[model samples]
Target: DTSRPTDLQRLIDGIIDDLIALEAPISGFFEDVDQLKRLRHSEANDYYQQVYGLEQRRQAYLSRLRTQFVTRLGIRTEQLMRENEQRRESIRRTTYGRVEDCIQWVRSRLEKLSAMEFVEDLEQLEGMFEEHKVDNHEIQDFRQNVDESIARQ
Candidate 1:
């Protein structure tokens, strides 16, 4: 007696009211599901197609982000290799020039490299390398010398 057709209508109405009170994204998801149910009609099908296209674009953007990260990592490694090459060239050029002038030239090159994201602790490295504290520059010099010497051999 209490469970009539009106009871079913009240239950449906309560569900609809709860769904309507959800946040925008949840509401949109539910709306899209509703539109899917109505897709036998023409307008609902068109709207669903548009949402599908937007989903595709969102996926493409995510894919592009992944590719870009890989490309940037490759570029960073390439930059490290090129830096080693240039350092060897610098050492060779420095050997033929005055020591003070060579140091200045190296300092200038290091200055240009100051903007690189690879250099996290600039002040600490500068103190370590420029002052011969930990043989940092000497290690770099040795690496350059070895590469150049091996190339000639």
Candidate 2:
């Protein structure tokens, strides 16, 4: 929070401390250059480890983000598909109801209606059924009845 040093501030403070320690004379005069080399090498190794750890954390974050996104997308897609299927079924039922009602209306007036009017109504009903890709056994039976009535007439 406000009391704690930010990561950047902490890094800056750490570097200042490291520089002071590195400048301090370990020996009386002109200390071994090898000791200096080793110190710098250790610092570089520590930085590399830090960078590697940050990289691993970055990769893990991305993996988790991708998984969550895919899961949400899949859930949404499945929900839409279910909605689409329900609408399709509702339309199917409605189409069948309309076709059935029309067939009944035509059959009620079949004897009184002229052959032309009966044929027109049947064609309209057939078109509705065909448009919805349906196969109604009643339609076929009605067709036979129409044919027999026309022949009798």
Candidate 1 per-residue C-alpha lDDT over 1-153 given as tens digits, one digit per residue, 9 for 90 to 100: 255545644554455344334324543753674455434344554564465455445434433433454343332346435634664575465444434444565686687567544456889768646655434544454454344334333
Show the lowest summed lDDT stretch of 10 residues, model 1: 144-153
* Clash-forming residue pairs, model 2: none
In angstroms, the error of model 2 at 97 is 0.4
Provide the global lDDT of candidate 1 against the true structure.
Answer: 0.48
lDDT (0 to 1) per candidate: 0.48, 0.43
Candidate 2 per-residue lDDT, tens place, 75-108, comes to 2345435634664565466446546665775776
The TM-score of candidate 1 is 0.26
